[model samples]
Target: MDKKLAAEHLLQDVSHYHGPMIRQMKQLVDIYIKLAELETRREDTNRKVALPREIRSVKQLELVPVVTATIPVDRSCQYNEGSFPFFRGLSDSVTVMNGINAPKVVECFGSDGQKYKQLAKSGNDDLRQDAVMEQFFGLVNTFLHNNRDTWKRRLAVRTYKVIPFTPSAGVLEWVDGTIPLGDYLIGSSRSEGAHGRYGIGNWKYPKCREHMSSAKDKRKAFVDVCTNFRPVMHYFFLEKFLQPADWFVKRLAYTRSVAASSMESIFTFDDIYPLSA
Candidate 1:
């Protein structure tokens, strides 16, 4: 009994204070993952049971009742009983102090207010350092907020240029020889400036509306465009999912002839290099 009590106390402290999971399913959770096909063609699936509460402490470990389970409409339940371990997700709360993520040790300021003041008062050297951190954190926050529905939505790329590194992706984003990415992509037929059609194979530039909506808009507004373009591609820029590195590697050090790299400051990835193909 003492052993069980001790274990229960230790787990209670850890799970209560540092339990990994965004919000304990205040309600019961029923998760089902389809497994690989069995050798006999039977629909055998591995189980990943994420039980809500601690199983060992419950009465009669052999029989714990499920309070509730959330099953999406697109689910097909066909798995054996399984138990999942506890996992903690990350935290989003931040307290900025003088444009810095604060240590509970000292609190003078927070959020964006501290950021602006620090930028205004810092020396040339310090300004350069702090500004970079602030921008990185800003990007992270944006990515998290924008990805709230990542479970049901995906960032599918219609074009290959959006990938982090590829010579073809960069080659496509130039004026001297603009690869004409729009030569095949599409937009709302009503929007005059919206290019609704690119070349044949490249037609999938905007794979899906959801993905396109989450991606940075590259279309420029041409004059005589339809004024009522609520769904037009020109209205939004989704740089959150598209990281700065999606443009080019700092050094390109692996080349046979090219040598030395100079990414002196935070330049838009789109500016230095183009998206991958």
Candidate 2:
């Protein structure tokens, strides 16, 4: 994923009118090898495509690259510097989602609205919700520009949903490299529905039951995964469990987790973070 991102960065730095010589090097290398093999196999046998007699005439990048076991886009590969800052990846086993896939699910609701009810029942409330959220996200500015009540209700639902997400404000960031969370993440422990104080993602108000007061501690309430939870993962005790979740939005010049102490952190930082400065 980071390799693709690095390639993207490099591509952007180059041209739209024409491809860069560095990128063309990939194809050039492959073609060069094929030509060399063809030449070797054909001391007596001949092929239509012969190896170019004068390789020096091709003023391409020095194709005789130094050998390395890994794709070194680090301090060593000076040309790729800042292009792909290599980082530790998830255990070579897990399939993590890259940002390229922003899946959009569209479902129509007839006047009966039975589809929404059916989806909410057939263990697909998440699908219904995401579709609704996707539409809400798509046309809000225009929706607000047109009608007042519709806009307020829309905004109200959004705000209410985010009431729990506020805990994850830890993930929201601003330019100049500031974590917008302020002090919200310190004491919050998110559970079903509301993000408590440490959770992320939109809360399903109908499905959520939250408490942050002393009662949560006094009642011996433990964060447990209930059968009703949408994404279907086991429960977690915030004090003991952590997952390093991350996403970027708002085209927002937000910083990302450069490093983390654990996998549960919503937004982590290390030395290389705050690179924006």
**Which candidate ranks first by TM-score, i.e. highest?**
2
Q: Count the backbone clashes (under 3 Å) in each candidate.
A: 18, 8
Candidate No. with top lDDT: 2
TM-score result, candidate 2: 0.17
Per residue, candidate 1 scores C-alpha lDDT tens digits across 146-200 of 7756312332111111111111110011112222323212422321223332122
Candidate 2: list runs displaced more than 4 Å.
Answer: 1-19, 23-27, 36-51, 54-56, 59-277
Lowest lDDT 10-residue stretch of candidate 2: 163-172
lDDT of 2 by residue, 99-189 (tens): 1221111121222221210000111123334344434543543554367764543322221111011111100011232222412322122
lDDT of 2 at 145: 38
| Candidate 2, lDDT over the whole model | 0.29
If scored against the real structure, what TM-score would every candidate get? 0.15, 0.17
Which ten residues in a row are the worst by lDDT in model 1? 30-39
